[model samples]
Target chain A: SAVISQKPSRDICQRGTSLTIQCQVDSQVTMMFWYRQQPGQSLTLIATANQGSEATYESGFVIDKFPISRPNLTFSTLTVSNMSPEDSSIYLCSVGTGGPNYGYTFGSGTRLTVV
Target chain B: AQSVTQPDIHITVSEGASLELRCNYSYGATPYLFWYVQSPGQGLQLLLKYFSGDTLVQGIKGFEAEFKRSQSSFNLRKPSVHWSDAAEYFCAVGAAKLIFGTGTRLQVFP
Candidate 1:
């Protein structure tokens, strides 16, 4: 399993501002996933970040709104653009440990509050 | 499409009591099932997961889950509930990308 260090553990920003959340994995991985967990809601996949390629966003999410960067196998960043109160949520980064029955490792998460 | 369902939105149990949290999932093939616990103001922790072989899998913190193929279910259980066990539980199904259930919040009373 890999350990992820996600920073800005939390932040408060004004509406229309943007925040970039970073995740650094101790070990290299092929794909990293970004998720949004709204208050009192289940986690939703925002996008899949693959090294050396443009991130693949989920249907309801877009690159402009939630741009992702996977500069390498061990690091990725997700930026929430043009923030609104509705954008307030916990953002998490995850990586799958490759094996027959491997599980995914998640970052501590970033709690963002848009005022 | 893969989807997970946790019918119970909230559950309350007395400390030291046995606990069970129901989870159901829909997927086309043999699904990768997982149970994760999220404490207040903390990250999501993987409790248990079922890939294959054993129908009943043990996880950290005395948590276990049984995967029933026919029922399309993967329910989490614990022999005794502790105060620290109170948290939000999510059931997810998938391999690369996970589809999570709405989640069940557990409340333990002494």
Candidate 2:
């Protein structure tokens, strides 16, 4: 499993501000996933980041609101743009080892709070 | 479409008691099942996973899960509970895109 280091474990911002969360992996991986876990809710996939290409966003998620950048195999960043109270959630980054037998590793997660 | 269901929202157990958390999933094709535990202020940790093999699988921290294909269930179990085992448990299905169930929060008491 890959180890991920996520920055800004938590943060509080104004309603109109934006916050960018970062994840750096200790090993190079083919794919990196971003997820949002709303309070008292199950985790939801936001987007999938692959090196050298634009991210693939989930149906409910838009690149405009949740832009993802994968500059390289070991680094990725997710930005929550034009934040609102409703956008408050815990964001997580993960990397899978490529099969059902191997599980994925997740970052500690960033707890975002919008005022 | 793939989905996961965790029937229990919260479970309480005494420190030496046995524990079981139920999870059911719906997916087409060969399903990949996983159980993850998340402690407060920490990241999600993989407890166990089932891809292909025997139904019974053992995981770290004395946790085990049995995969029942006919029932589409992968329930987690432990012979004895510990206060440190208190956390949120999530059941997910998929290899590339994971569909997670609403987690079950375990409350362990001495």
Candidate 3:
């Protein structure tokens, strides 16, 4: 099992401002993913970050809006740019470990509120 | 593409009563199934997973899930419910990339 620590547990930002959330894992992992949980909605995958490679984003998400950085196996960051009220949501960092059946270990999550 | 479906959007159960949350999936082959629990303002915690072999798999917090291939379902069960168990539960399927269900919110009443 891996322990993921995410910073800025909760933050309030002004519209047009940007916020970057950091995730640090205790153990090195091959796959790190970013997810967003909007108000009263299910979690949606924002992007997949592999160390030393460009992040792969899912449909409807662009690198310009959500830039991801995976510096190494144990560290990654997700930045929400030009935040708006719609960006108010919980951003989660997760690491994929174990085998094919193995599930992911997630960070506590960052709650962002845009005013 | 892999997708998960949770039929019940919200469930209310009495404390100490048995509970069951249903999950169904759509995938080409036998996919990895998982159940996760999320408390208010907290991250998701894995309850159980079913990859292969035994149909029933046990997990932490006294939770268990059964993978029924015929029905394409993996339902989470608990013999008894606790007040602290009131939270949102999600079902996910995949290997490297996971597709999560809409989630079911459980409300335990004393």
Candidate 4:
């Protein structure tokens, strides 16, 4: 399986501050994804990080608020801009190995708490 | 859009007993279904997945799931439960992005 490592495992930030979470993969491949898990809730797809192209956000998520940057195949970053209390959740990064060969693997996740 | 549903929110079973977790999906076309397990304060791990062919699929940790297209269901089952099997299990369906169920919390007693 793909191994993904994410930065800032947990953070507590002020309401007006912002946080940028980084995810790095061990191997180069396509189809990187960002997901958010709200309090006691299921994981929701935030966006798909396509290398050398803009990310495709989900229905409810927007690009401006959650700016995603996929510099290359092995790295991607998700920035939570102007965070609020409602933004407090666990942000996860997943890496896929093309088709169903290896499936998707998630990082330890960043637990963000906005006050 | 693809959606997944897990009927049970919580399940308690004793060690050496059989275990089952039910999941249903809604998609017009054939969809990829997956079951993931998460331990306390840990990331989610893929327990098993059903993509195409072979209705019965075996996965890690002595787990298996059957995909029934007619029933729109993919249920996880194990013949014998281990105390270490206690965790939250999530069922998902997708292609680009996954639609996940609320997850089923399992508790095992000795």
True contacts kept of each: 0.86, 0.86, 0.68, 0.75
| Local accuracy of candidate 1 as per-residue lDDT tens digits, B1-110 | 67899999999999999999999999998899999999999999999999999899999999999999999999999999999999999999998789999999999999
Q: Which ten residues in a row have the lowest lDDT in candidate 1 chain B?
A: B91-100
Per the 3 Å backbone cut-off, how many clashing residue pairs does candidate 2 have?
Answer: 0
- TM-score-best of 3 and 4: 3
**Residue A88 in model 1: lDDT:** 94
lDDT of 3 by residue, B28-82 (tens): 8878888989999999999888888999999999999998999999999999999
lDDT of 3: 0.93
Ranking by lDDT: 1, 3, 2, 4
For TM-score, candidate 1 versus 4, the one ahead is 1
Per-model TM-score, in order, reads 0.98, 0.97, 0.97, 0.96
Give residue A23's error in model 3 in angstroms.
0.5
For candidate 3, give the lDDT of residue B66.
92
lDDT of 4 by residue, A83-111 (tens): 99999999999987655484778999999
- For every model in order, the TM-score on chain A comes to 0.97, 0.96, 0.96, 0.96
Candidate 2 regions with alpha-carbon error over 4 angstroms: A99-101
Better of 1 and 3 by lDDT: 1
Best by TM-score: 1
What does DockQ come to for candidate 2? 0.86
Pairs with steric clashes in candidate 4: none
Candidate 1 Cα outliers beyond 4 Å, as residue runs: none
Candidates 2 and 4, the one with greater DockQ: 2
Using Cα atoms, each model's DockQ against the true complex is 0.91, 0.86, 0.82, 0.84
Chain A, candidate 2, TM-score of 0.96
Candidate lDDT (C-alpha), each: 0.94, 0.93, 0.93, 0.92
